[model samples]
Target chain A: MTDSITISIDGVEIPAETHHTILEAADKAGIYIPRLCAYPGLKPNGSCRVCTVLVNGRPQTACTTPVMKGMVIQNETPELKRLRSNLIEMLFVEGNHYCMFCEKSGNCELQGMAYRLGIKTPHFPYLEPKREIDATHPDVLIDHNRCIFCGRCIQASKTFDGKNVFQYIGRTRNKKVGVNADDGLGETDFAATDRAAQVCPVGAILKKRVGFKIPIGKRIYDRSPIGSEIEVQPKDAGSAQ
Target chain B: MANVATNGKRIVISPVTRVEGHGKVTILLDDDNKVTQARLHIVEFRGFERFVQGRPFWEIPVLVQRLCGICPVSHHLAAAKAMDRIVGGEKLTPTAEKIRRLMHYGQTLQSHALHFFHLVSPDLLFGFDADPEIRNVIGVARKFPELAVQGVMMRKYGQELIKATAGKKIHGTGAIPGGVNKNLSIEERDGFLKDLPQIVQWARSALKLAKEYTSEHLKELADFGTFESNHLCLVGPSGELDLYHGNLRAIDAGGKTIFDQVDYQNYIDYIAEEVKSWSYMKFPFIKSLGPENGWYRVGPLARINACTFIDTPEAEAARQEFKALTGGKPNAMTMAYHWARMIELLHAAEKIQTLLHDPDLQGTDLVVKGERRYETVGLVEAPRGTLFHHYEVNEHDQVTRCNLIVSTTNNNTPMNRAVEKVARDYLSGTTITEGLLNRVEVAIRAYDPCLSCATHAMGQMPLAVELRDRRGELLDRRAKGVDAR
Candidate 1:
């Protein structure tokens, strides 16, 4: 077992493991550092800068940066909050996020983050990129319009399902999640029950015939804001990771 | 060309005011100052059909409500009903159906209250010929503070009812494909019940105000853009006024049935829309009568004329008095729309009161599904008129085609007729007075036209008036509430 180390975050010292990142350590201490591209048990991609925090007076992604002894980090500063909100808004403008009708509206992490961060509207102009929806799959759908290129599905498919179904293709602004198989998702060896199908943080990868199964008030984030669960964890609660 | 008024000049009121959306009126005058031609032009175009293509079928209900802010609940429910068919969920559970009804009634109550008090009351209370600045909602507030408060409170109550049932005041996702997403909780029901009686009492007072105003100004209002046309709406199983769900019913000026008990799913078989080059909106007519004379009136007056009796007591009694005014014939007076609207407002209040008492609203059986279908049509009696939503979903659950015939579109031809009638009766000299502008607006307001949904736009645009000679030379131009050259 790795030895535990103490790190000061926002003026409070918290115990962290030798290999734990700032986000993992903060999360274990009941502090939620907002993230989009990083998930538990998955390698931190640091593609989305929502969790950017000050570490030793330098900005670093809390998800990707490992904790060190006597390290001082600032997570909830006003500058960091604005920075995170801007990153969230950038994600909104990069895709066609129609939250009003989106099946994943109340349950979506991206939307829940926006609600939690008090983003009434995105400051950036909508790109409104015309993207094709691959509905050729009989039991799965990929609406590229709502894709944020977070690569969670890509990682989940490769790591959890032992299948290389999704990948990041293209470069810069045109970058998107691409399928391994030719033609469409229907032609791919993908199942609706796959971990990749359920790992999308947005409405991009949705199972067919099962959208909006949960009611409004009963949805995951309706009663509580995003990150509330992590924030309400016991101070010494064990981390899922 | 020969019978021209003042060298064939045209008086154009671009972007009519105090209405939901943007609209314009062009009145052509001959050399003798006779109004030669009048047209109410819908200048904005909402390509909602093209926008909806390729979107998943399930998204249609919540997606279509983006069309209008004033009556989003109407569109939401109408589209959801159509999607329900696509999902084989048309036979909704009791809880689902009741919740939807509650939402619709709440919408009607709020919409009617907003229109009557905020939009229409200014003209009625202060007189149509009053100064343009003082003849508005603020003026009504300053002069008749109590009436304004009543309107605000009534609107707020109805909105709260919608929020509780629909989940939000704006772009609600309460109604879904096949069923509602939520049931009215006991707590929400109690909260609304506490305020129900007050809303009903206010509705009664509003109805009385409209009734007295129409009676006092009967002579003047009789000739105020009044025309004999067909009236159409939905009627319940026993021919009661049903705003939420009912078979289609149409009545002639004499209250004679043109058609009754026709399933709205086959609405295309009976009703067809005509596209005129002058307007973006379509003129829907009874196919049997043809576009020439098949044009009919809808909304409050039409609803009152089409239904045999209202279900609720106070509204039923009010409807009787309204019908008796025309000796049991369809009331053709345009201004009588106010009185008719108030009656419906009271009916919606009474319906809300009754629905709150039902235990089904709290039931957990909120959804049902059966055999799936491809193409479907959903119709609802929106606050303005009958709104039609038609869609065709493919096997992949994506919408292949969509067609929406909004209430304002249904009343397109009738609105033009009203404008022409008002212009022909009021326009005198080339000098465009504020009274003339107000008169044209008053006539159009009778229909409560929502130009936004007709030619959809977001932010409010001021009403503009352009006076031009027959030679297309600009004479004088003025935009109300906005400084524009």
Candidate 2:
């Protein structure tokens, strides 16, 4: 038997399961908590602090923190909105995300979050760090310029695909996602059909020869905002439909 | 910079203004203060061709648009056309081709309007000798309020058309490798239809103004920078004027056909680029004629001279009157670019109106693909002149090689020729006057060159004049929009 609990989010009390994280609970009740590093069915790493919210008067990542009975969470406050926006802006400046020409532009989660948060232009000065590109893979390519280090592929490959193909290589500012083999993604047993290939939230790790397959208006994010799938239709309502 | 040591004097114009990108002019004179050599130098360098390597071929149409803010649509379409060939989708569906054509006509209309009213009007209305402070768009507004407003509205209408067809005014994703991304909505079509008549009327008025200005100053304008040169442009299958898709055509000053109906994909066989150490922009000329006599003029003047006739009624009438000025020969008068540009403006307006009424725009079939190829070339007539985009893609769909011959680059030699002619005709003595400096600018302005597209750079600087003696010592320095000593 699963334990049931109730939580207060932005002054609205919603019933949730004990195992549900703050993001999962809020999503169940059709309340959108903006996030980037978190995805459906993937374990949350909380690497990106975009989903940071005040849980019981303390800032915590909503995607990693579990829901408790009668706990008060602040998600849509002005202060929290500003913090989330700042985090999103930092992610943008730290990477060379040329959204205009990127293949994943209309479908990219980072770009979608920017659109949802109304970030016409980032306030911070761009770092414009030089990055490397590994296109040796016959079926896949990685462009480090657009990588946000979300760790979704890292988790998805290991847990879902049952393969340990990706890992974090460097430390601190020099850190980047490294392949399991020495040569590049080509040396690894990473196929384009792997679950990891479908989990990238950005254009960093892409399957070759499949870019811009969808037109402008029919893209994933073009139909709706990033979190509208959760906000517009609740879990119960979506199941009933 | 120039070799002032060998010359008697050198006049350095650090930057040219009222143009799209950054450029400088250095006029070297003999001991008697006679102009001997003049070169237009492209100061800024953006290695766009090198940067484009290793990028995905499909992303090129949108990526190359970053080349120029003023004429991005030209790059977008040209790159898309090349990619279409790479994907073996060169035979675009009627709907896709028409939509792209609509976008192109909008670009020409808006770019021409902006250049004529905002950039060149002050020179034409106030005369070349007018005060520098009062000779600009602001002066035009203060003197001719109604005309200024018309210019603004005309430009705005063209922008709306671009937004409707291309998806946005900047960085549009409407055009793709195989075809365009969207069809014109009925609502968008009706919205443009509402303003079509007013836009056509403004285009006619602008044409009349340019024609009257040319006629009033015919004798003086003839001697300004007049010279015999070859003309180049793209002509339709039947020798009609077509800006979007056509075959290559070149005509000599005496109306002799140099090349007609040559396929642009084999442009290398007919045309070649020559590099000079003094300028970053390459000089493009006809291969058979050699670099000396092969240098030709492009843009509006070239189009008017190369095409047999325009399909539209009003622009054809205007073209007929324009041709009569040169007795049906190629018009070599440099200032006549303004008049030819207005005739194109009218033609672009007429194209937009006709395309709006075509039901093919609302058709659903947008893209098509076939067996793939690796290397391809695409060409289109931009607002300035013919633009070329060539790419070689690998099996992985990554671009292996890239090359671009922008319109302004094709006109590099001719621009230098015009600068030298103006320098010899108007410039005399050691002292530099504002009116005399403006005469040189007026000659370059006739071409409406976009140095940014030619040099692949972004920043533009002001025009400065520096007169130095044979010893290379700076004597007098005067700059437009800059402090003068």
Candidate 3:
């Protein structure tokens, strides 16, 4: 007989593997747990802390935590939601992320997560960090004020290109991403084709020279999340039926 | 001890550890100190260049950006430049140039920070004998929290700038052959200006820390110095220092200018490739002489040495301090690599400030729309060294030919020589420990070479390294899969 582990997510029973974390099992069973800096092709960085879920009453990142048997996961608990909203608030204020002027206005992961969590206004005051637009190279650009330090670009540089181009520099609140010796992109060994640019989930490490080619409502990857089979359901689905 | 004739034998290192991409290094050594043959191999293969043959010129930037994760900006820029040249388009508005320079500066900042902090710092800060398990930036974080924090902040600032200027961080559709799609708002510019003072302060502090560290570890750095080779870089029209756009020039270790105005098309004339049977990557040497005699180095150390003077006052001051430390023009001292990096950081910050303060930055005329036609080459000095992207397009704007000479390629000979020196110094006298080999690898990593971008879209194959006995029997083998990780 095959071994199976039972788990409960929001009072719903589900079968899971023995090695799975409560969060993983819940996610596998179609439970929604918000996240940033979590990509399928990369290691879990857990920097955003947006995917926090309550497991046996403690908050945990769903991306890194593995599944365990007989585990209980609470994805949309009141506390968890509040924590997620607060995290979103921190991201909005930590950088000058004015969505109206942002190139990633409708398509940004940060913006999407905040909207999904009902973040109408940033509770914290804007920590307007003065940043530079380094478009020295014809291709890549870096804007410090919008970066959330997810380390995705760094990971991409290290893993994808085998080039350690993008890196996290500085400490909390002052932390930023930059090239070797903080040079301009045009001056780095970084190629115009490096995947480091793709690793950035936000607008922090953007393509140089190229902006706003596709008009609003014409960009790709703009459809509903449901189209991908990873459906987003209402908060209280069980009671609706 | 008997002298064994190990001639005609091959030694291959697959999945060259401590390198950015899937590549191998093969060496053929004789009984004497002479290296009979050496080749840097690129094992992973994909037909990316071929695949791009028929794609729309406008789409080439996006497609080429996927060539390497670390240097997407280079490819994106090159592709855009090529397309612009082909279409015979008008120049980008002054505002666009400023914004583009700003974004490029961000990339340089983040990329260099990654190299100095995450990839090579382990070898510098901790003794080379430190366990590989703990010999990483993570370890640095635990030990030297302040430095690690500085690195993180520096990298974040650059990336954030990229995001704010472009739409997305990666594969952003910001620049086209004609021009940029969006213009920067006053609020965004003002917001960025406000944070400049803190960033400048942070850079200064980081520079101080680096200087102190280098002084404290002078002996360690001196011991780490490897082979000496000629330097080549790009300089502005007035023979002033230039990294973004300039003419190519070569300068020997004796401070003599060797070649000037080396055209991009004639690169093959000055640079020759040597292929080894064991390794897939080819070693490129200066064609001024033959492969056996020619050797060249590029990147930060090479660029700083090649330039006569820096433009910015802050960078000039840093350069003066660097010269004071080296007691002359810094030549092959590997420790100068750190000094060169600091100087570049200062220059990048100062340059960014200058670009931001330009009155024309707030203008709306950024992009100049046009169609595609002729062939063109885009060249720049990446932080690591000189980079060239040459493209030829037909009437339909389809790429007919695409030739790229990346910064890593420019440093090929020096890299091999550095490896040989490290192997001889560290491995010859001591026992063959993985740490010793890793140290040799670390010397190469100091350049922060990117092999994936050098041979992009060639194939999807694993990089393998094999250690062989005198008779070519495999002693040890290591391989990494072909995923874009």
Name the candidate that leads on DockQ. 1
Model 2, range B1-485, lDDT digits (tens) per residue? Answer: 11122133333433456777656766666777777766777867888999989888888888999998888999999999999998888899989999999999999999999999999999999989787668889999999988889888888887877777776776677788788888999999999999899999999999999999999999899878888899999999999999999999999999999999999999989999999986778999999999999999999999998899999999999999999998999999889999999999999999999999999999989888988999999999999999988889887678899989999998888888888898888776775666667887888899999998897876655545555555556544445544121
| Candidate 2 ranges with C-alpha deviation above 4 Å | A118-125, A136-140, A158-165, A180-194, A207-224, A235-241, B1-15, B468-475, B482-485
Q: Judging by DockQ, tell me the better candidate of 2 and 3.
A: 2
In order, the B-chain TM-scores come to: 0.95, 0.95, 0.87
Q: Docking category for candidate 1?
A: medium
Provide the overall lDDT of each model, using Cα atoms, as 2-decimal numbers: 0.85, 0.86, 0.66
Candidate with the larger lDDT of 2 and 3:
2
**Tens digits of lDDT, candidate 3, B1-485:** 11112223323232444557756544434444333443455665555667566444666766677776665766666666556666555467787766667777777777777777777677677767777657778889999888788778878877777766555566565667766556667787787788777677766765665677777878767767455678888888666567666777887777677787776546666777777554344567778766776667888788777787789887777777776765665457665676677678768777778877887767788667565456777777777777777777655334667767778877776766666666556544212335545655666677778877666634444344333434444333334333312
Which lDDT tens digits does candidate 1 get at residues A1-241? 6879999989999999988999889988898888888887678888888889999999999889999999999988888889889999999998899887898888898999999889999999999887889888888889999998888898899888999989888887788788977898888898998988987888999987666657667888998888888888847543321
Best-to-worst ranking by TM-score: 1, 2, 3
Residue B344 miss distance in model 1 (angstroms): 0.3
Best by lDDT: 2
Alpha-carbon error at A190 in model 1, in Å?
A: 2.0
Encode model 2's per-residue lDDT on A132-152: one tens digit a residue. Answer: 787878888899998999998
Cα miss at A234, model 2 (Å)?
A: 3.7
As a whole number from 0 to 100, the lDDT of residue B81 in candidate 2 is 94
Candidate 3 chain A: 10-residue stretch with minimal lDDT: A232-241
lDDT of 1 by residue, B1-485 (tens): 01112334433333467888766666666666566676777767768888888888878888889998889999999999998898899989999999999999999999999999999999999999888678899999999999999999999988887888788887888888889888988999999999888999999999999999999999999989888999889899888999988999998888999999999999999999998787777889999999998989889999998899998999999999998888999999889999999999999999998999999999999878889899999999999999999999888889999889888888887887887788778766665666677887898898888888976554555445555456556444444544222
| Model 2 chain A worst lDDT run, 10 consecutive residues | A232-241
TM-score of chain A of each: 0.96, 0.95, 0.85
